[model samples]
Target: MSEPKRKNRENRQHGDRAAALNLFPLPPETEARLVIYADLLHKWQKTINLVAASTLPQLWTRHFADSLQVQAAMPAARIWADLGAGAGFPGLVTAIRLADVPGVEVHLIESDQRKCAFLREVSRETLAPAIVHQGRIEDILPELAAPIEAVSARALAPVPILLGYAENLLDKGAVGLFLKGEHLADELTDSAALGTFARYEFSSIPSVTSVSARLLVVKARAG
Candidate 1:
């Protein structure tokens, strides 16, 4: 990298880190861990497609804060399953945030081996309470016996598809907390019209960081 470009990237990262701290305001230890996480992400991102290149400049608000808000929505959930845990949005972030708490476990389910490696590296370095599951979501969900209290995903799939992926856990009484975009209302309506999500009750809360985003909460209706 040229001198000017290298300096510019360093400056951008410093600014991004500052913004992350300002938005979240976590405990000192948690803040340190997230800093490390962000550093590793930036390093790995050079070779691996961990995040969108466009969003790289705003890693703090766009990715970290977005994931942190999901954690904020369900603070009491001790055991979590993050499906399609691409780049470990809410999953690894949840684990890091809850690492100090007792009995907190975040299951990160991803099919891609490379992403799993990345998740593992972050977990090991940050000592985050995450279990990286490197296999198909369908294949791994059945084997988990952690009594997960909640299941989460971000930019993974549509409502019905997510519910389908989480059906096993939902049937076992785990709540689903999915991060979604502005079109969530239409997605719900379309899924309802198709009766694809009849078994689950859906509700949404606005995202604290992004006006165009929402946190979709799902639970199975009683028989």
Candidate 2:
């Protein structure tokens, strides 16, 4: 590679490292799998538009790290359902991390057929053990047979609406781990008015970009 290109790659790698500084170190095998996942994402991006065009340069920190942090928060959760799992942020990332673990499964629920096709291909190529559920979250949650230990969604919807979509799973004892932005306070206020059956614990995301973002862990119960 030319000097300028090499320097740019090095800078990108450094940025990825800096953004992931707060996450627990992954085992070598898991790290290798994530590398494969990232490469596949880039290759598919040319045709599918898996993520926002602007975020492509910071794929590792912005997308991968943002997703991996959720697994760090809920380490004990083995079975997860990722709603609106577009491009498979936390869901596919979680599956890649837990690929070798016994009984680990991540169900990726995406409504868009094209996105679902991309997700399925990625899962198969990476051997990530993710089951792609191609349908609306409202239609699929009730039909899930496995007992979901935790649920996750990123950049999906407001807390109240997300809770409503995950209501069935939440009522069945699945905890929600959602990624939200600066509007958390407003979301909480709106969710209160909606009489949601879930409670949330908010914490700052260990990210280099957008300090306003947070990790919302929702504990839900039957009302």
Candidate 3:
């Protein structure tokens, strides 16, 4: 393909993604905040490795849309903890989208000080109800004063480890919303073999953004 043709095709693809984002019920203010968030991400991504550089071209569909699906999975969750929230995918996005809702809080857990700073900046700029915790997941998750209603992690760890990381909150009734790619079946098998679930009920929700991706929802079953 010629250079100009390729460039035009790429631009059209980007435009299509931007249009696809409109399918969600995001408020206009939320959309504006996401634009600011995307700008900050691009600026900071230059110095630090926030996200995979290759995915930057499809930031709207690849990251933002993928994250938004998590919110769609559990719309009623007001209190959430996003583990390993690098560049704040679904966590920061959720906070931004739900900025209008009262009593909403999204805690973003990230150990990197620089990334935490970035998260803080976006939260401050967008007025998203996100609290950046610059510490390990194990240390910070256990000490949260507010009861987490949902726990989220994307491309962070395997199913077993994720369950272990959020076991404290999950045992206390918080649902776990994990974003997994094509290896979800294998992960679920491994999770079962490892006895990861003592009381949690696991269900898989298909992701609207990618066919290979899935939203794994873990909720504690009623006794």
Candidate 4:
């Protein structure tokens, strides 16, 4: 890394730590695991296109914090499935956070073999209970043995198509929590018009990164 870029990463890390302490504090062990995961991600990014190059400087805040924030939405969830888990955003982060909890399992579904290899290495290194499923999201969902408590995707697809991929899981009693960018309103509007998720109540948590970003939480509607 260049001097300027290294300095920027350091500054961002410092800021993200401060913000995390105030808003998203983790247990000591969990914090340590995240440090390990971040280091591995940085090392991997040198050759592979894991995350976007532009966001590398703000990896802590933009990716880690953004991914970690979802824990608050489903505090008691034990089983999670992350669709299109490229580079293992929320999936790996969640697994690291819940590493100490018994029966906790995170399934990271990614189509790319290279990304799956990275996910497997991270899981092994961190000792996080993550199951890497190397296949299409559609193909993997049906093969899961049991219903997941939560399903998530980050920067994967539009709301409508995401819902389509997640429909089976949702019907099996899994709640959907997706990380969406600035155009959430437009996406939600477009999805609603498609008449999908009619029996669902959708809510959102504003991302810590910026006001334009949000974490959309979906659950079945009550009778």
Candidate 5:
């Protein structure tokens, strides 16, 4: 009988095949990294549940592609920060894609020490410009002397709670590029109720699944 791990690899390969069929026009380098990242996820998953069990096989489409969608949405971003970056979606992959670009940096923030350690390993292995900050977003925001051009989060939490953690730099001009699902309208309402923001736009997510996927870009009004 074959090892269970080998079976899981076979299943993961099947998932990668499905993701390849999607063809969302990712950069060549990014496409390569996606494959590597998928393998890494499968390996790390044995020790830690970084991603949802059901989505493991389809990591490419469910995670990488979903994150790459932001590329088209914000083509010329320079600096980026992924708040609550669990497993480096829209952050590590984002940085790897932009790795060659001069002066571009992507920061992946995570409060969990283990997650941060894992993120660091991936960053070093991939030579990505992502640095994992092992600290709470809320606690670190007030002290981050430098500012980032954009902020991102996926499956983090309500927009209000999201922005609350991002309040420091967000009060400045940094744009919020949050990955959201279909129920964005409801979250937007709740976010507004939390307090006022500047401007925001919602774009439908481009993915293989017909499900509701959207990117919410929010900006603060100029003072």
Candidate 6:
């Protein structure tokens, strides 16, 4: 294809994606919170790399909206648990967006103390009403005070480890909402070796310009 044609085609594809996706329109408060989140991340990143420095420009599409997609998926009715909730992507965003939904709660789980501190501050600054856990999946899942309605992860770990770590919560009726990139098919094949599940749905993240932005939702049926 000619260069101009290719450029136009790319622009059209981007436009289509923007239209088909329910991307979050920036609310004044949400926008402010995102600014705060960015500031904190930059300050911390001087010592600890939270997200790839190259990804800063795409932060809104790749991080916030990507995670925020979860809120719209469920109609703001379910309890959510975000595993390896590093830098608080969907978990913090979900908490912020789902704030007014009665009985909605989001749990942000992380093992690193520094990241835990970040998550807590995110909740504080965003008034996200999210619970931050500073421990491993094994350390906290079994002791959860109540069953969770939803569980999710993003760039957390491979599907196999995610499935293993979240097994307990999954057994307690939690549904999975995980974000995966281009290699999703390969990861799913690897995870299938573990066992069987009741349902699995894969949807591309329309809000992301990043190629292969897909979210996987899995349900673990009671055995």
Best of the candidates, lDDT: 1
* lDDT scores of the candidates, listed in order: 0.90, 0.82, 0.89, 0.87, 0.74, 0.73
Off by over 4 Å in 5: 1-22, 191-194, 197-210
What is the clash count for each candidate, in the order shown? 0, 0, 0, 0, 2, 0
Best candidate, TM-score = 1
Model 5 steric clash pairs: 198-221, 205-213
lDDT of 1 at 44: 93
TM-scores of the candidates are 0.92, 0.88, 0.92, 0.92, 0.84, 0.79
Q: Where does model 3 exceed 4 Å of error? A: 1-17, 191-194
lDDT of 2: 0.82
Is candidate 4 or 5 superior in TM-score?
4
Model 4 clashing-pair count? 0
Query: What are the RMSD figures for all models against the true structure?
Result: 1.9, 2.7, 2.7, 2.1, 3.1, 6.7
Number of clashes found in candidate 5:
2
Task: List model 5 lDDT by residue over 149-174, tens digit each.
Answer: 78888889877777777665566777
Q: On residues 17-93, what C-alpha lDDT tens digit does candidate 6 reach at each position?
A: 35423456756676676667766776887887778887654566667777777766666446888888888877887
Judge candidate 3 at residue 210 and give its lDDT.
Answer: 88
Extract clashing residue pairs from model 3. none
> What's the CA error at residue 73 for candidate 2, in Å?
1.4
lDDT of 3 at 131: 95
Score residue 27 of candidate 2 by CA lDDT: 78
lDDT by residue (30-72, candidate 3, tens digit) is 8899889888988999999999998887788888888998988
- Writing each residue's lDDT as its tens digit, candidate 4 over 164-199 gives 988878777889999999988888889455578586
